[model samples]
Target: MFPGSETRAGRLLVRARRQGVLLSRAFGGPEPGEALFARAPKPWMRLLPHFLALAASASLLPTTVVVLLGDYGLPGVLAGLLGVGQAAPLLLAGARPLSAWYVVFSTDVLTALALLLWGGPLDGAAWPWPAPTIVGYLLLCLPLSLHLARRTLVAVWLSTAAAAVLVGLLRPGHSPGSSVLLVVLSGVVLLLGGALRERSEAQRRLAEQETISEAERSHRRLLEERARIARELHDVVAHHMSVISVQADSAPYRVQGVPEAARAEFTSIADTARQSLAEMRRLLGVLRSEGTEAEGGGAGPELAPQPGLGELGTLVESAVRAGVAARLTVTGEPAGLPRAVTLNAYRIVQEALANVVRHAPGAEAAVTVALSADGSALRVEVVNGPPATPARPLEWHGTGHGLIGMRERTRLLGGTLDTGPTAEGGFRVAAVLPRNEPAPGENA
Candidate 1:
C-alpha cells in the first residue's frame, strides 16, 4: 500500500482528505485565479478552465526538452518545437471537453512516441513521465463525462495498461509489469472520484424531492382545516338561526285571545324578528358554503313553489305587512321568465325590502320590477324614504355583516345593487338581473 492511499481487495483507496496545499502550488489557488480575471464576464469564465489545463500541459514541456536536448543531442530549439506541438492540441482538448477524449489520447501517445524516437529505451534522456499532463486531463475531463459505467471504466484501465507497457518496453531496463500496475492504480483513482461525484449528485436530487413533497403535504393540510371550519360554522350557526325564525313566526298564533292590543304588538315584533332571522340564516349559509350549493341545485329548503314574476304583487304586499310603506310598479309585460332568473329577482327584491325595515324604519319605500324593450333583462329597484326619526339604534347591532352579505348574494347571481341617499331626501336600492335562466344545468 502507498502512504497517501490504502490497498484493499486488490484496489487502491485514496482517502477523501483535503489536498489543498498540493493543488495550490500546482495550479495556483482559486482566489488568485478569480482576482486575476475579476473584471471579465461570461466568455472569460467559460474559457478559464481550458486556460488552466493548457498551463498544466505546458508545464511538462521544460522537463521533456531538458532530457532531449542534453542527452539525445537534439537541438534545444527543435525540442522546444516538439514540446509545443504536443501541448497545443491538449489546450484545444480542454476547451471542448467532451469532444476532446480522442484528441487527448492521441496527444499522450504521440508524446510517448517522441520520447522513444529521440532516444532509445536504454537512453537516460527518455524519462518516461507524462504525469503532469495526465493530471490536467483528469481535472478537465472528470466534470465533463466521468461516470460509474462498468464497461467504460474497464476499457480505460486496459488502454492505459497497454500504453504504459509499450512505453516501458521502449525504454530498456524499465519493467513493463511495474508500468502496468501503475497505470491500473491511476485508473482506480479516476473510478473512485467518479463514484463520489455520482453519489453527491444523487443526494442533492433526493433532498430537493423531499422538500417539494413536504410543501405539498402542508398545503393539503391547510385546505382540509379550512373546509372543516366551514362545515362546523354552517351546521351550528345556520341551523340555530333557521329554528329561531320558525319559532318567531309561530309566536303570534300561540299567544292569541289574550288582550288584543298587546297581542297585536307582540305579533308585529314576532314577524320582524322572523324576517331578520331568515335573512341572517341565508347569509350564514352563503358564507359557510361559499354559494357552492347554488351551483349544485339551490340548497337548503326545497323549492315547492318558488316566487316568480307573476308573484311580484304578493312580494310587495308582504313588504307592506312587514311595516314598510311599499308600492310595486310594473312597466312592460312580465311573461314567461326562467326559474333561476325569477328566483334571483325575488331574492333581490326581498333583500332590498328587508334593508328598508332594518335601516330606514317607518319610511315609505317603492318596489319597481321591470323588463327591457327586447325582454332580455329584468330591472328591480326598492327605494325608500329616509327614516322618519333618528336612525334606529338597533340597526348597528350584531357583526354588521348583513349589507356585505346582500352585496355578495347579488354579485353571485350576476346582478348589481346601488344603495345611497336619493336627491329627493330618500334612500334608494336598485338591482338589475337577467330575465332568462342560465342553461338547464348552469349555476348562478
Candidate 2:
C-alpha cells in the first residue's frame, strides 16, 4: 500500500461513521413534544382525527377479534389480546403516532408467531397479516407518513419488510403471498400520505411567505408616504425660511434709525434662517434620492406648487365636476395662517372630499372652513350625505393611502382629526389645525 493509504482510509471511515450517526438520529423515534398531527386552521378540522379514531376503533376491534378466533382458531384470550392491541393503537395514533406504530408493529409480529406456533385449521385465509390488521396498520401509516421525517418513514417500511420476511421464513409454505400483499399495500399508502404531507407543508410555507411579503410592502409604503409628506412640507417651510432670511437681512436698510443691537439681532436671525434653509435642502436631496430609488431609478412627475386654503374653492369645483353635489362654505373672516397649517388643511379637505366622491357617488358633500374665534386655529370639515347611487363593492377598496396622508399632515401640524359615520348615513371628516406650527418635541 502507499504511505498515505492508511490515513486516507482512516479519514474515509471517520466520515462514513459521522454520516451513519446523522442517519440514525434522523431515523430515530419521535422526540418528546413532537405532535402527531399539525394544528388545523379551522376549528371543525380539529375534530376530524378524533372522529376517524372513534369510527376505526368501533369497527375494527370486534372484527379483528372475530377473525382471529374464527379463522385462525386461536384461544379466545390470545385473540382478544391481539385484537385490543391492534385497536388501541388507532386511538393513540392521533397524539403519538410513532409510539402507536411501535405498539401495532410489535402486536403484528407477535400475532405472526402465535399463528405459527398454534396449530389452527389450515383454511385458505390470509395468515400473519389478517385483513383488519392490514387496514389498521395502513391507517396508522397515514399519520406516520404525515408527521415523520422521510428517513424515518423509510426506516419504518424497511423494518416492516424485514419482519414480514422473517415471519415468512419461519413458516416456510404458509401464505407468503399475504406478506407480499401487506408490504405492497403499505408502501403505496405511505407514498401517497407522504406526498399529501409534503404538499400541505409547501402550501403552509407559501402562505407564511406571502404574509411576510405583505407586511414588508406595507412598511415600505408607509415610509414612502412619510417621505412624500416631508417633500411637500419642505416646499412650504423652505419658502418661509427664505422669506425670513430676506426680511431679516433687509430690516436695517428698510427701516429708519435701527439701533445697533437690533441690527445685530436681525443679522443673527438672517444667519439662522440661511443655515436652516441649507439643512432643509440637504434633507430634500436625501428624500429625492430615496424617492428616485423607490420609483425604479427615475424621478417622479413634476410637482405643482403646494396648495393652500385659497385652492379649496377650486378643489370643490373639481369634485362637483366629478359627479358630486359639492359646496364650499367659509365661516368667520379668513386670516393669514401658518403655511403648514393652510397646506395641511387643504390636503385634509381634498382627501375627505375625494373619499366622498369615490365611495359615495352622487352624494352631496359640504366643505366648511371655520376660523376659530381667537384666530388660534382653523377647523375644516367635509361631510357627505349617503350615496344616491349604489356604493361600490367591498372588494373595490382603496389602498388607504389617502387617509394615511391626511392623518400624517394633521399630526405634523399638531392638529386634531375626527372621522366617522354620521347619523345621516354619511361620512364626516373634521380637522382642527393650530394656526402656529408645532413646536419641536411637541406631541400631536
Candidate 3:
C-alpha cells in the first residue's frame, strides 16, 4: 500500500508491521512508478507455476503408482496423463472473463478425486499429484474480490477435508491425525491468498472510474473557454467595425466637387461593410451561446428602429452606392409582417448584398422583398450579375464559413433558402420566412 492508501479494514486483518512489509513489496516499494505492463494480464506468470507442478507430478505420480498399482511402465504413463489433465482448464480459459475462478474450481475437484483414489499420505502413491491445487489457488487469487472470494475458499476447504477423510479410510495403516492437520493448513493458506487478491481488484476498478471522470471534466472546460472567447470578440471587435462603416459613408458626401454618382458609390460601400459586420457579429455571438436565438433572445444587439419590408429600397440604394447597379421592386402589400419575419428578411438581403460586394464586386444586382399572395410569409431575394472583370480582386479572400452561417440563421427563423447561380450569368440568394403571431408584450 502507498502511504495514504492504507485502509482500516486492511490493517485489521494481520500484524501491522508484517502486513506493511508485504504490501510495500506487492506495490513495488515506496517510490514505485506505474508498471510497464500494468493493464495487461500476466498469463505467462500464472502458467509458469502450473508447468512446474506438471513436471513434479510426472516423476512423483508415476513412482507412487508403481508402488500402489504395481505396473512398471503403465503406472508411469497413467500418472503422466493425470498430471497433464490438471493444466487443461487453465489453458482453455485464455483471457476469458472469470477464467481464473473456473480454473481453480476444476483443479480443486480433480485434486480431491485423485487424493481419494490414492488412499492416504502414508501410501505416498500419488500424494504429490494434488500439489497443483495450491498453484491453481494462487492463480485465482489475482483477479477475484475478497467479498465473493470467501465462498470459493470455503468450497476448496470442504473438498480437501472430504478427500483427507476418504484417504484415511482407504489406507488403514496411515496416521489420520497428521494428514488431517496438513489438509486444514493448506485450506487456510488458499483462503488468505484469495482474500489479498480480491482487495487489489476492487482498488483497481475504483481508480479507473476516477480517471474517466477527470477526463470528462477537462473536455467540458475546454468548450466553455472557446465560447467565452467568441462572445468577447463579437461584442468588442464587431462594434468597432460598424463604427468605421458609418464614418466612411459620411466622408465622400461631405467632400466638395464629388460627383453624385461617386458619393452614392461610397455610401453604398459603407452600407455593405456595416451590414457584413453586423451579420458576422451575430453569428459569432450565436456560436458563443449554448442555444440559438429562436429558442430565446435575439442573436446580439437589437436594432434601435428595426428595418422591415419598407427599408427594401434603402437596402438597394446602399448596394448601388457601393458600385453595384441595384434596382428594387415590390409585388404586393407587405403590411402586418411579424417582427421576427421582417428581421430575418432584412438579414437575408443584407448577407446576399455583402456576398456580392465580397465575391462579385462592381456587379449589377437587384433586390426584391415581397409578401406572399396568402399573406402568410415574406420572400426576399438578392440577385447579382457576374463580376465586370474576368478575375476578382487580389485582396478578396473567402474563408467559406459565410454560406453556412447564413443558412443557419434562416433555419432558426423557420425559413428555407434557395441559393445558386442564375441562367443570366448571376448568383441568387432567395429565402422565405414565416410570420408567427406575436406573444404578449412583443411588437407586431
Top candidate on TM-score is 2
Candidate 2 ranges with C-alpha deviation above 4 Å: 1-38, 41-62, 171-177, 255-262, 289-303, 357-376, 391-395, 422-425, 437-444
Candidate 3 local distance difference test against the native: 0.52
Candidate 3 C-alpha lDDT tens digits along 22-72: 443343211112221233335564354446444544544444344433422
Clash numbers, per candidate: 3, 0, 6
Off by over 4 Å in 1: 1-51, 61-63, 66-68, 71-82, 89-95, 124-151, 166-174, 240-444
Q: For model 2, how does the per-residue alpha-carbon lDDT over 1-444 read when each residue is reduced to its tens digit?
A: 111122233445446555444333332322444544334434455566767887998899999999889888889999999999998888877667889899999999898888768739656878778889899999999878877777878899999999999888876777677889889988987787777766655555555565566557556667777887888888777877888899899999999999999999999999999999999988877777433433554444425567777887898889778877777877764455666777788777777766666556645444343434136788877777665566552223455566667777788888887766678666667787777744343221
Residue 411 local lDDT, model 1: 65
Per-candidate TM-scores read 0.40, 0.78, 0.37
The TM-score of predicted model 1 comes to: 0.40
Winner of 2 and 3 under lDDT: 2
Cα shift from native, residue 77, model 1 (Å): 7.3
Order the candidates by TM-score, highest first — what do you get? 2, 1, 3
lDDT of 1 at 212: 57
Q: For candidate 1, write residues 393-442 as lDDT tens digits.
A: 33533222233434554564566766666775665656666555333332
Number of the top lDDT candidate? 2
